[model samples]
Target: MRKALILSSVLLPAITAAGIAAAGSEEKPDVQTIVSKANLVAYYQGNDGKAKVNMVITDKSGNKRQREFIILRKDVKDGGDQNYFVYFHQPADVRRMTYMVNKHAQLDKDDDRWLYMPALDLVKRIAAGDKRTSFVGSDFLYEDVSGRSLEEDTHELTETTDQLYIVKNVPKKPDTVEFNYFTVAIDRKTFVPMKMEFFDKQDKLYRVIESKKVEKIQDFYTVVKSEVRDLKKESKTEMEFGNVQYNINLGDDLFTERYLRRPPREAIR
Candidate 1:
């Protein structure tokens, strides 16, 4: 399951109920279980979901840019492989641009990503190394749009509060990523990740992702608003999700490269 921050999806009520029940129990869950449950709550909502997102990018000097897009996601398994499709709708320069990802659960297999530029009439494959780069000039990275692999890090239960469970994650291979370590505060009842703080190599806090608004949709908890702040750059991106629907039964064919060149009707609609 991918870490959750951007884009919204309908969560499974069964899973949320189970998590709440476990939280009420006297025994505290292990760090791994807690992380796993948080992942599911963040990314794996219903089998398939869709949402329209409006993004506002603010720079250090306070200049702002806006973007609108539609994001579609389908899970092959509840907590394993998945697929994501995103289509741009606003900003004439990026209109009709599309991005797709084939997320893999295996540690050895990297996710496949592609970007479509309508103006250039070109399809570009995004390499694994570039996943951490800014996404569409926004503060959120390509990896953030989907999520980072759980196996890539070692998780520890650093602190547990009355309402939140704090977990610190250190990359198993620190050299591969930018951050030295990150910590997430997970809601005890819903298992939703409320805040995440990233530390640089020098142990300086440099980045943060926060879930600003969460609402229960279709009897499941969903993040409708979120923000990502880049401290060093003094920039931030705020995303608001609307028209979110779950269990849409989206077809797999819609995610193919063929559709990348020409978006499916569902995406444009």
Candidate 2:
């Protein structure tokens, strides 16, 4: 369940599921060789962590924009219900946020999500239909942001380059996903994901994720620098993290619906 557990997507359609196992075929390809590319998957582990993100958006025609956020993670149990907190913050403005609190006893399915809006002072539930859409208007899908079974994606090993497998991702389900498909580079020796390129519904490369730094924490080595590149545009998303601690105590009070609607707000000076 350690490595394999990360490969399944509970609600994702078979074709676009995030973490499915690759089929075994002699002439076809070896997906396992490709799925482990670039040591990207290895960074997903840990119970507590945080990252400061810089997102840049650029169009294929060479236009760009930049934004920032702080991502915090911790596991907590409230009133006998166990859950994890994935929090985001933009220090300068309260008007902008993609903040959500996800409560799940199970990994893939059975999760409750709440988002706080500064404009309405309301915490609303994200519609199920909208979960597949991109979060914060970024290239990464919402499913990729919140949580999905990592092993549900199926892979096709294209070839080995730089001692890693160039894998093409084929969703198990045909039309259930937002993005087209993924082409990731998996490390040959370490089973890590090095680079991930995503295509659109038209099967054109639009986004690419590249790993920058690797660190060991809580028995799992995590990606310290992750850059999400938008090929169609002139911008990218850079996620950087340090002091990557895991399994630290996160108070249950922080994961409640009340907190989601009205998290601590600094007093206006």
Candidate 3:
């Protein structure tokens, strides 16, 4: 979700410095601070970035489908508002389809999302209720493409181990989401969320998002591969990132509705 990989050009050094400063410190950061840092590390990387992603969707019967897309993201402010543009590039049927999001940080404001279906020649506004629905028939939800706001959940530091800080998050408005609650296991050193487990109303674990691989790019620790599994359905989506670059100075104009229909050259390339 949200690229599934964390690649930072501008913020890595700061994170490293903070990590060095906290070395051997017995007192751990509060739950809010830990969650905030994890959020920033996961979603708010460089000022702007780009990644080419290949998604493999597999059903319970073991049939598989693949989709290829390029994602472009620009941060309005670190740990605040952001913009996302995704252009599908493969599998003929979905080629040229695009999705855009104007993500607002305010708790009272909802993110604006749009989907462009080239075959139908329609640009449709995605309803807030649909954010949790399957994304392009994949296990990942639409909300996974951008991110869910930290303010929407109340967090508690449930456990701390030598390597991770475990936090349990409960939705502030339970009715708005499908999961009863979720717990995130964040790496202590990098603050990257290593795994997230989502439990259903019956308190049974039904979904899981986990980081599969991490790499250092441009001196930044980044997650390069991940998977989302629907345990109940025995289906899963595996995503791999390639050709990722950060701080590319992407312009705001590239994310506008105009480009959704006629994708910019940068997006297609």
Evaluate residue 191 in candidate 2 and report its C-alpha lDDT on the 0 to 100 scale. 57
lDDT score of residue 103 within candidate 2: 39
Per-prediction tally of clashes:
0, 45, 0
lDDT (Cα atoms) of all candidates against the true structure: 0.86, 0.55, 0.85
Q: On residues 1-269, what C-alpha lDDT tens digit does candidate 1 reach at each position? A: 34331111234445555777878656666787787778877888888899999999999999999999999999987667899998998888889999888988777888888999999999999886556889778999877777776788999999999999999999999988999999999998899899999999999999999999999888668999999999999999999999989999989998898999998787776
125 Cα displacement, candidate 3 (Å): 3.7
Name the 10 consecutive residues with the lowest summed lDDT in model 1: 1-10
TM-score of each: 0.88, 0.65, 0.87
* lDDT of candidate model 2 versus the reference: 0.55
Q: Name the runs in model 1 displaced over 4 angstroms.
A: 1-25
Error of 3 at 136 (Å): 1.5
CA shift of 239, model 2, Å:
2.6
Model 1, position 31, has a per-residue lDDT of 86
